[model samples]
Target: MSMFILVSGPFTDGRVWNEVVGRLRESGAEAHPVTLSSRPEADLETHIEDVVRLVDSLESPGELVLVGHDYAIHPVLGAADRRPERVGRIVHLDAGMPQDGDAALALVPDPSVHELLRAEGGPGPVPSPGPAQWQRWGSTEGLSVRQLELLSRLAAPQPPRTLTQPLRLAGTAASVPSSGILCTAGGMTVELVEALVRTGPPQFRKLADPRVGFFELATGHWPMVSCPDELAEVLLRAAAGEGRRLTVPEGESPFLGSFLFDTPERPRVRNGRLDLHMPKPDPGGAQGPRPAVLFVHGGPVPPHHEPAPRDSPLYLGYARYAASLGVVGAVVEHRLHGIADYAQSADDVAEAVELLRADPRVDARRIALWVFSGAGLLTADWIAAPPPWLRCLALSYPILAPLPGWGAVGSRFRPVDALRAGGGTLPPLVLTRAGLETPRIAATVEEFTAAAEETKALLEIIDVPHGCHGFEIHEPTDESREAVTRAVRTVLAHLEQPS
Candidate 1:
């Protein structure tokens, strides 16, 4: 069987390649998901060495295909450069090809991105793209909650050093056949494509080379999630040495067939106090013992596993996307809110992680905690005194201050007071608020920022009203989805960073 190595982009582990890898394997390809070491503290040479090791381990006399997605184009290309003989072709899947003098973070037009890099305390040059510029380009319309969580995880502060260091690709374009899958529907523009191409090394200067190919898709950036069949076909075509334009059907719903799991309710009692509703992986292929995400639902009175409102695009959409990405999402019922108690809710998240870890199919190292609104408070408390195995966190629209009596019969919660009291160092925070400019949401974000001593980012969506708490639940307008998606993508990229 032909061998394929799938390398994921920054702020992402191997799980992001779940759909792509599954499709490749179903088509009889021997696929291996490679995890790259992307710690901001690590030097460029060290990162290159890590990829070399993985590629060498897979070395065989038979030809192999190396696929790099997004930020991974750098390391994957470096690996190919190191061992071109055993490798068959290098596929740049909607990714940027880095040259010796090109800066990785320079491509991102966000000054806040530099703030994040600086917060990470790395010695690297920050890109000058101001927050205003990035805000103009980043969009988050139609994103699911799971997608938001993925974005939040990816949105962490990146190390400035990694962005400042230029990629060093030494081979000529003839050494390997290259292909680019640009998803136009995901908001990629022809102008951006031209800019990316122009930034390539001298070897890629000749656009007419048969070995060089470019194709655009009218799907979200995550074609594997939004349009898997189309993406699979594209990969197959690339593998067969056929390069042609591939586009989604006219007026086809982008959300069709995007979710990979059945939304079944597997309610079970755990730790004698919490209820866990574990959904099965979406249809197509089940990757056993998948890494799990503990969902802490918002609302002080809503059921933990209630069907998300149709207007809330982030909830169901996010769950399905995470499952499609090979993550086992567990919605935890928290205390006094969402059908459970605060203590029990925290315990439930920990227990779910433990259970998944005990299962042989899970990687254990990739478990994550995700919560929103009131549940965000519970998640933050839990993280303050975290379990040893906790891998990362994704908290959105968090209520940092309990106020005097938020849920008490007559007491009111004062966010300002809470911020004053909880003045300790905090985890990296990704804060999102509605753009309709309500005083409450703005005040909430302002309070949280003041209390946070660690890295914190604020994503303000324009035109969203304050009452639309679950705006990201349903298919948002194109503009909102794009805004949210960009922020989420940045967060996910940050989480994928090596600790």
Candidate 2:
């Protein structure tokens, strides 16, 4: 009852995915490789319409899944935007991430490609690549001689408008489950670099989504040609809800955005049940103590909560991300709802900080707490006391006010109250709010922001337009990615500031 509607970009055809499709079908999954429009006048919208028509033609579309490569990443996303309910998920191959309001050329990491597009200003279908086209892309995707010949022969010039027309995201498209399959065999592309960036690119922004997953193949840009079997296996796993992996791990954090190839070093046991993800130090960088970030996850534990994994996905990637940027990152597995009050959660935070401070790899003087949603409750005491060892607090769509239905407890913990009772001088704080999140709980950001102002606390609130309560963990839009990067930078900036 699921289907992978494989979408190809310009310069290629449906045949490109033939091998992957075969492998997928062999695994008992329905797969279809869609050839994009080759007409000279076809624009971005037109391309998306074509794909939509194809999906509509299906007698019974069980669960539409879009698997896009290269430029197809945009059109397929647009199709999903136009038919969100029908489309269950999307998978972005090494192809660049779609940027709403930007052209394909704009997403390329190499600016020379942009220059080339501009110099060859278009009137109709873009010209096909010369015979040397394979010489250029083949090496990147690790194309074999036959693969190069076939791709070169099938390579058709795209409609100039297709590359130029800006992508239009209806917001709903980002809400769907998504995954990224990064190609690692070729020279680093923008998509690959963005994942490791301290502040990642718009395309990689959705990586923060808790629902989205990531994978990497030890092949070139065209994994279909270079590593079809491996690519197919990953696609199958992703479709089955197991796709997220740190393709080329580095100072990667738990997704909500992550770190580089070598990041997210193997998890080491810290205090009982606490897992630490440290970034392998940069070889060329100076040797010294690094800043630290303690990530606290949110959510109330169900009566019989099902544990996902021993390692924290969001925190692991985040820790690695921080490590990539020259810092030590750690994630704590605290009792989500073991106690009636917030004291236990606060104690867990304190324990994490104590452990980090004692670690030889950490700079005890500089550490920050990056809290997500419900975990903000634990920040109350720290916000009131302003611990000297803590540099700042970065909150993501936090639940600041005390809610009656949180759990049956003695008291409804209130962050605003704690800040108000503070000595008026709190640790510098940076908070992010998803603009599109539910009005009731989302209003917590404003409420706490106002309270922080009244208490003369140093606070900065970042509003991510079109982002929902858990935007980073599900899907990312330009707004959410930028918001996360900005908040992280704020925390780092605060830490870097001379005391």
Candidate 3:
């Protein structure tokens, strides 16, 4: 028999787990819901102590399973680390994986909330939003109106220190087996995680550990409120290690596929963060420096990924294909290691551009920048002020607007707002839209296109009706091939225009 300990996240307490605990009990399992210190000054340590003390007080003698939801995972992990011997299993329910010295604020997926917490001289305790604004925390899908009212009525402001204080760990708890409950409505799924793991990022690779199990809930982030019975059932299943297991296939990278067009060997030279692919000279003779297309691959990829994006098969293929067109193709590796490092990554892009211009083999007066995916944010700056040297700008399945709940952090990176703010004509812009893109992301692209129309920006749209996000590498159909070819040709045509 397993004794279950449930810890609720911020803006609520043990009461939030009432129905879930009841269901667990009805199933013949011993369950306890924890309520931490409500004092305004209570910090992370206080909450960790609360969980540790609860474990000490439990009189049950069987396996102990610690379950944490959202921000509560911090304390749960801390306590588990301190009492590793007693904890049989640890479950992370719709919460981030925070390492030692990480503050909960940094783990917040919402750019707006992250900025607020990072700013100085803010409110002491963060107030819970109204039920209508619950999406800011996580998706409210599947939550009934009565449940929303209950949540609003019982919500409490969270202590500031609970989010500010860094989580400290001795790493002992890492040895304990763990389970993860991913909420699809909250923007994560087993499929997405598996895809990321396939990208060969070092941090995501740890998820393939056999000791870890994963389960997905169709409900929103607050499983306790939206689907308590289901949550309880999953909790029991997690204790039994009966969830999906993530495995890494031993073969070529899944993110890598055969390029639409093949190219002959090209000269590859590395200059700091940029990989320059030099085109073969024409049969007549060698020409002067040629125009360059700098490919900025999109990602919040882990910093420790081996080979990096520049060396990845997809990016390498893009660069090589550019060279095949008789133009210098360049791939830049920037430090977009995590969501919070967008500003830094943008700076890296600027630096890479300057480096490309300084090279003698590249034409400094003509350059086209092509950005993809999350890297679309870096385009905000270039769009706001198109330099004379910038021939064209291309974006593929780019995020043009800030994601919901991505408040201030995404504000600076909104290309849609940037175009509106610039209120000036931009160079020819080519955008490739994915018909089957995720709704939230497609919304951003739609918002950007709408802004372009309003601002009368010079834009051409390419549609991949049957394509998903990253269709070039993932779709592999004739449509995907045609779209890529058209985009590359359009960009090259712009580069060839009078300068």
Candidate 4:
């Protein structure tokens, strides 16, 4: 089981997570809360070190969920970037998203500057809003007298230095999975959130990240104090990587004979969570080791352990077809696990490739990648540095540009930008463009194809006339069928090419 590390923002301590920790512990997860120095002199680095030290002491740093609320997000992110491999995911509670070069509080501009001075204490030390403030912030709808009293004691003032300190992310934290939980139940409004995301400060803007699962709760900013039970469940689901998982049911087989292969009974753990489906070897071992194809299914894959079926009809029939053609075919479940950041997703593909090469039934030196839809972005790394084993890449309606919605990490994920850096010549490449695709999608692919040619990338561009995106399976017309047929032939033919 993964462990949960609860981190409180300024003015509060570990006690903020008391209710949340209790519920998580009961759920059998190893939950603990870390307190940051609230001393007037406590700066950003002081808090960052505090969290990093706790993470370092963990038995399994990789099995961690670092939950940060409000101001604590900076230090939590600092620790994550410092030790990217140690932290698995970061959960932000009513906090703004920080970009690569943003300062802590720089992104969270208040709705009005007047509200800050409107409170008591003459703007001396950032006065607490008192009971009325708490009520407006969120509800104590179900909280007992003790909970409310405890909340009062938890409110205090910490140094403003933490916010003033500029946050410098080296793109490492982008590798760590992340999620955001917005408080709509309190004084916050959805329309206001949308406006903030649109207007300025990178913080609110990141909430719209397609990869970061967006959730709303009808509680105040202090949901831990107001609705710990409901808050705990959200964190639990986030920890479990519940994204907009879309599952496609197993499709009808169109192979000469029913697949002689067996579906693995259960998922396996490799670098991360993964499931490998392979074709059963021919009877009496007719076809020994053969060239392999790793099917990279696109996903916002379904929730944890729930129907992450990557084997669409196209993949199923293709896998069977590969087997009949005397080639080993493997379908991989590229469950994002909310690590939708391109860097980590690419790492996953790398790990899966290694697993494929290690299989005795696969011709390790002759492997190919077949990627479809959104997963096309992951091909950037492979394209930039084509492994000798990577004979060819068959990209269907591939996305070779930076998709801000996908929370792309950096310019390297942008193919055209990466191509400017100049690298090894890409191996034989076959790119199929769906004629009916949106103009933006079509333009990006066209741009990529043109750019690839300048780099002298051995490339083949195939246009499927009158074919829509995913037409290969969903709306398979004669044109679509021929296009799919060409894709299969392209990979095999590329394999036959002499080095």
TM-score list, all predictions? 0.42, 0.48, 0.82, 0.48
Give residue 146's error in model 2 in angstroms: 2.3
Ranking 3 against 4 by TM-score, winner? 3
Error of 2 at 174 (Å): 1.8
Ranking by lDDT: 3, 2, 4, 1
Q: Give the per-residue lDDT digits (tens) of candidate 1, residues 83-156.
A: 78777778877665465545555444343554555575445533322322222223323345566466445433
Kindly indicate the candidate among 1 and 4 with the higher lDDT. Answer: 4
Model 3: residue 41 alpha-carbon error in angstroms = 5.2
lDDT of 3 at 293: 98
- Candidate 2's C-alpha runs over 4 A off are 108-116, 119-124, 135-141, 187-205, 245-499
Global fold similarity of model 4 (TM-score): 0.48
> Candidate 3, clashing residue pairs?
111-406, 112-406, 112-407, 112-408
Model 4 lDDT, residue 357, Cα? 83
Per-residue alpha-carbon lDDT of model 2 for 1-499, expressed as tens digits?
5688998767788888989989999988889898888887788888899889988877644678789887899889889988888887898886655556656753433333444556744355555655456433323556667766777787887777887788998688778888777675544433434432322212334465666777878776778888889988999878876754334323232333322223435435466645565666568875677788888876543223333222534556566666666666677777654224356667777877888888877789998988886677777777767778788888987878643222222233578888877744677888887676554455666789899888778888898877655565444456666776787778888889776
Which of the two candidates, 1 or 2, achieves a greater lDDT against the reference?
Answer: 2
RMSD list, candidates in order = 25.0, 20.5, 3.9, 16.2
Candidate 2 global lDDT: 0.68
**Better lDDT candidate (2, 4):** 2
Q: How close is candidate 1 to the true structure, as a TM-score?
A: 0.42
Among all windows of 10 consecutive residues in model 2, the one with the lowest summed lDDT is 403-412
Relative to the true structure, how large is the alpha-carbon lDDT of every model? 0.52, 0.68, 0.83, 0.65
TM-score: model 3 vs. ground truth: 0.82
| Tens digit per residue, CA lDDT, model 3, 118-216 | 678764777777878777777899998888888989888888889889899999988898999998886777876675565433466678899899999
| Backbone clashes in model 3 | 4
